[model samples]
Target: MSDPIETAIFEKLAKADPKSVGGKSIEPSDVAKELQPEQWQRMLPKVKAVALGLMRQGKLTITKKGKAVDPNSFKGVIRLRLPTEAETAAALAALPPVVEDDDDFA
Candidate 1:
């Protein structure tokens, strides 16, 4: 079964909002605070996986000025920023058309 909390984090990322997933900006302290202690135990690895998607898309960056930064760190308010027209178009264009599969259940 998929972890609901992890799913929530991914859903937030797929919409381009990192802060919504219990993080401030990719800061460890912020994430630890935003997520509950129990959630945190399950959140770390999940966040790391989703963060990779963000990194691949160039929407998030990793830096090194002192201690290593957590990719899930976020800051400020949680806003769901919609994709721009061009981005939406590109994403839509990349998707395959839906196909019927009679051999399997819906």
Candidate 2:
């Protein structure tokens, strides 16, 4: 089963209209906004788990450049490439369609 926090992030990313690659790394605000206080509390561990999983899979990498990249600093920002149209279409196609009365889930 998909972790709910990761699912929340995915859903946020899926709906986002990313306008720029620079500035702040896509703030977690959008996803955070979707969750209630209780939901966010429950989601923290799952978010960490998903991040660790991505790190283990080598999808997320930490670059080192002593001093230039301090772990404590938040300035070392990198942009994430949003999927291409074809990729987005393929992703959307991979999902099962929403049933007529399934708006709540979809």
Candidate 3:
């Protein structure tokens, strides 16, 4: 099971729309604040870590200055958003097709 805080971060990103930001993206701070206004700052690091993990899984995108960055190494300001439909399709297309092996018959 995933951490509740991490799950919340993913939920927020999934709900955001690019058109809402003039076709840009939403910031991590925005999700944190929405989840915990009183201690949003304290929760930021965890949220960012969760976002980065999601990016690595190809379910999220981290952008700096409107361009995607290495989620594991990015510094300074950044934004988080769900992969676009086309982006998702492209990623899925890039994956090796799954094949069942006889070992699974055990």
Candidate 4:
């Protein structure tokens, strides 16, 4: 089964803009705080993990000091955002269409 907390993290990322008012990338803490005000600190680790997962899946990007970083290896502050439209289109093109198999019960 999928983790609901992880799902919530992804949903928050999906709704976040890639750039902020001053053109800064959105930090993982931003989402965490938005999801759980005073409890954001406890939520940080999980949020970062989910962001890394999304980065690996090409659904999001992670950066540090304005440069992209390896999500699995990065150990410091990082930012997360939905992929650009072009990246999103390319990722969609790379995926095979889902086809439900009706033979599961047979």
Candidate 5:
């Protein structure tokens, strides 16, 4: 099944997209706090992991200083936003194949 957490993160960012009548961007913590109010810190990493996965897929964008960045090699603060149609092509990055496993730490 598709991960609900990933779905929520994607949908939330979509709502903040200009094409969807939104002009603001969201932080990864916004999702963590919303979904795990009592223990958001634990959820933050998971949120980022899924967000990075989405970014790598070219289905999302992770911005730093209002500029698109390579998800595989970005540091410090980041904001989540949707990429423009023109950016979709350039946003796609070559990444190592994902090795599936049942381990939670994978």
Candidate 6:
């Protein structure tokens, strides 16, 4: 159910190569630029928003100075990465079940 931008952010972060960035993390700008080469500059804010939301959900980790920061107070530069298996599992467990709507107009 992710929108294009959210999908793009995760795709970019998931495919990040550790050797290239010293770790499996990438800058928000990287995702923005890949989604819109020419107008990439405008995508930075959206990228951060998705990243922060994911971090709040525990599916992602946002870091500053190689340590996890409080999403509510983070500022300046940041890096995004997928959480470890255990962390992801915990996050998944915490999420409410998705209930599909089944309205009928008979």
| lDDT value, residue 80 of candidate 1 | 22
lDDT of 6 by residue, 41-80 (tens): 8989998998888877877878888877777798999998
* Cα shift from native, residue 69, model 5 (Å): 1.3
**Residue 90 in model 4: shift from native, Å?**
9.7
Candidate achieving the largest TM-score? 5
Clashing residue pairs in candidate 1, if any? 24-74, 24-75, 25-73, 25-74, 25-75, 26-73, 26-74, 27-73
Which 10 residues in a row give candidate 3 its minimum summed lDDT?
A: 15-24
When 2 and 6 are scored with lDDT, the better candidate is: 6
Positional deviation of 30 in candidate 6, in angstroms?
0.6
* Candidate 3's TM-score: 0.66
Candidate 6 to truth, TM: 0.71
lDDT of each: 0.43, 0.41, 0.72, 0.68, 0.77, 0.79
lDDT of 4: 0.68
**Model 5: residue 5 alpha-carbon error in angstroms:** 1.7
Candidate 3 residue spans exceeding 4 A from truth: 18-24, 85-106
Root-mean-square deviation of every model: 9.5, 12.3, 3.9, 5.2, 7.3, 4.7
The alpha-carbon lDDT assigned to residue 6 of candidate 4 equals 61
Q: How accurate is candidate 1 locally (lDDT)?
A: 0.43
Residue 73 lDDT (model 1): 69
lDDT of 2: 0.41
The numbered model that scores best in lDDT is 6
Please give the distance, in angstroms, between residue 61's alpha carbon in candidate 2 and its true position after superposition: 7.9
* Model 6 global lDDT (CA atoms, 0 to 1): 0.79
Candidate 5 lDDT tens digits, 3-93: 9678778677777774742245789998888889999989988988888887777767788888888776898888887766655666554
Better of 1 and 5 by lDDT: 5
* Candidate 2 weakest lDDT stretch, 10 residues: 62-71
Taking all chains together, each candidate's TM-score versus the true structure is 0.34, 0.36, 0.66, 0.60, 0.76, 0.71
- Model 1 alpha-carbon drift over 4 Å, by segment: 1-25, 66-106
